[model samples]
Target chain A: MPDPTSSPTLTVDSAAPNPAPNPAPNEASNETLGRFNFLAVIGRIILAFFQQVGRLSMFTASAVSHCVRPPFFPRQLLGQMVEIGYYSLPVVGLTTIFSGMVLALQSYTGFARFSAEGAVATVVVISITRELGPVLAGLMVAGRVGAAMAAEVGTMRVTEQIDALTTLSTNPMKYLVVPRLVAACLMLPCLVLVGDVIGVYGGYLIGVNKLDFNAASYIQNTWDYLETLDVVSGLVKAAVFGFLIALMGCYMGYNSRGGAQGVGVSVRNAVVSASILILISNYMITELFFAQ
Target chain B: MSASPPKIALSGVKKRFGRKVVLDGIDLEVAPRESVVIIGGSGTGKSVTLKCVLGLLKPDAGSIKVDGEEVVGLGDRARERINTKFGMLFQSAALFDSLTVWENVAFGLIQGHKMARRKAREKAIEKLAQVGLGADVADLSPSELSGGMQKRVGLARAIADDPEIIFFDEPTTGLDPIMADVINDLIVKCVKEVGATALSITHDIASARKIGDRIAMLYHGKLIWVGPAATVLDSGNPYVDQFVHGRADGPIQMELRG
Candidate 1:
């Protein structure tokens, strides 16, 4: 006798012919199909958006929480800052400085055609402070620091060093994400500040030395055309872009899959995502500040 | 000898990823200062089992006790405290490329435990030597080392903290056979020297036999057979025999992609 509590067993009948319920099984599949028909599309999009937003906010929060905690690896932070902020100086400075000089020459040429050569200072300062400094800094950082962060952490993730960190009682977020995020947040603004000065200085150098403009008059005019909001707003944008760049770096790196292929993909994604996010955020902030 | 509780124990641990079941249910135990090697083929959830114990992957339902303390659902702080007693050598030699070999070895000691740099440096150098690497290699970046040397450095780092529980995941993979044997020997010597409970997972049967006092074979997310290393060949289980012989014509089928 079969016990009442016994589990059901599948019995195979060698001699019996089983009938195929084609229509019934097909109808079951049809019901399964209907369940996913309209809901799938809308649910997928919503899930995707929420997932993106969740990841972004989670990255931001993980970074912020680690910023104020102990087990502070000052050496790692300072090294990252130097690597990210200071080492980036030459590239950002050169890009903006040349841009400033080019802007001056271009402005002179354009304004000269219109018989408005005196407007060069206004153009240079407004363009450099309002647009070039933050954007150029963001792009350079996306290329340099963002790619490095992705590659380094992606390799770690693939190789399971991140796992090792957790096993060792060290939080990978605290150790990896925090220092980078904090360094970027703290350093990017400073780098942008430096980039602003250098870019404006480049404009001055070209305006006076190459463009035959009077130095005192150029400086005075450049200063006169500047509003506090322009500088403050650019700095604000730098801060936001800084956070985005680092967040993208950490996110892509942390979530990297596959192996060597995955690390390469992560690096590419980090740069692309960070650059796009920076531009989008820059526009949003600009609109917020000057949306008259 | 009077018993202190087992160093590590898992009671019917199970883990699943979506529809794919990684570990169905696992029951394991590692006594203090004992070396247990888990042998399994790829995709047999060997790594998953190790990760469940490491707390990297949370099991769906079951208890994992380390030092007789329940760790399955511990909070972050408690988890961190528990993790301090564990060290792991990953499948790949996952040394920090940015840091020198010595610094990589000293990472947990300095970063996690707040050991002073000088002392940590000294300990790191000593650990490196214990792994048969010279002091000169200590100052060089991990990127500069060969795969075998990196594995040694990884091993050094794993034991640098002298953790009570050490997990080695595919420790001998990606190395020359001789170098693999060398690593296996070093792992045995190191684990023995520290008296640390060693739990390892590998597909390498040779490595399993070499390092394990007791060996368990995982098949279909379950431990099919466990016995002393000397008796593994004669375990009398068809699955274990099929696996140990590396045969394709057994219960495990080879999927031919046409």
Candidate 2:
């Protein structure tokens, strides 16, 4: 359980030359400076959160707006779809398959004493759809897409390409974030659905070959026990997880403060935060759905 | 518009990060097409001052007006409107490594203006030519070029949009003396050709005199002196004298944390 909130601890040399950025100019009164600092820190924290949310909101809005605009970058969108969605398939697929296999194995040992071995199919399908498919997919995408997004945008930010975009009268949020977010929002459900199928198939293999269950019976039992709500809930969770992963990636990259060190921190923070937020949000969504 | 305004103006602009005050109170103005170079040592609020006017950093106090519109606390739409009129050449010649030379140069034209790729590529090539690069180099990535060439690409990118205001932040910091002079010449020529208002911050006195119509010295978060570039040698300010001479011993002390 890697806590996302844990700050990276590095033993930097005290003598390392800090960018002793000069103090602000004199117009701020002593009173104003005090208030400004207090507010700025609080504002920065709020702003950091807002910048991500705002960027996400603005990105989504602009993307939707662009859907109706004349000069749509369909080529760029297609390229991003490949980069962000299609290319990410193998990693998500493999992780889901393995998770399903392991979950089936673990659940069987626990459920064996109760002689409820038939419940393995139901447990696997329900758990995979409700939690594992979305959560594991979220974490996998965090490691894959989240880090990649952070590094790509983080580099652009530090290198001033983002500023260059600004100078050219382009909204970076619309240009950079929108395509990625759109791709993630649209594709994660597809990925999770694929993941759900693969995961269930994996559970079936383990149940039949390893645990000596009948193959026909396992597949039939998986479908029999799975409600439409279960699959729909996973798809819904996938969409939220997708938004969070892309949001955190864009957020950390957009606000990358320091130079090289800042970019590294951004990548790490993006992946860690997205993964944590996914699980936390998953639990909340689950609680909400089942509470009644 | 009711009478054309000054190109850019900042009056008593102040910004601070925690206990660290980056810009005390910067009051400066750039008339249309004028070139102003700010000279200061490292860690002096030179870059922060530029950032404030660029609307990248909001000031704690004071007014920043570009073409007579107060920009200090403007919203994103307003800020983007102001930003579109400006271009910046960063200290490191921060060209996008992932993009080809032409694509990097044409990024603004394409992404910002939504220009067609063909027209933007043509425009990018034209800009590259202005900076002494050939069409052959346009398709190559920025990383393939040397430091000087990369700086040229940066200069090309800066002017590609033909912005009304251009900022050069330590444009010659890492270049050799000859290369630095070449960059200075390119900057002067390009700024003149574009007839854009130029505001540059640098410690290089030679570069300052070469590229500036006027030179201002920032020390202790204040503009200690601002005058015509020709008169910088005789500014009669000790801090300016110490800085311009690059003396080992001066009022500016190296901070040794206790």
Model 2's CAPRI class is: acceptable
Clashing pairs for predicted structure model 1, backbone only: none
- How well does candidate 2 score on lDDT at residue A175? 73
lDDT: worst 10-residue window of model 2 chain A: A7-16
| Tens digit of per-residue lDDT, candidate 1, span B42-115 | 88899989888888888998899999999988876788899889888987877877778888899889878889
Model 1 misplaced regions, further than 4 Å: A1-46, A109-114, B1-3, B254-258
Q: Can you tell me which runs of candidate 2 are displaced by over 4 Å?
A: A1-79, A106-116, A210-213, B1-5, B254-258
Interface RMSD of each: 1.1, 1.9
Q: What is the DockQ of each candidate?
A: 0.61, 0.44
- The sequence of per-residue lDDT tens digits that candidate 2 reaches over residues A1-292 is 5454542332233333343343344444666888788888898999789876777677557556654544445565677778877888898889989989998999999999999999999999999998899888889988999999999899899877787666666667767777777778888999999999999989988999999999999988998999999999999999999888887888789878778999999999999999888989998999988888
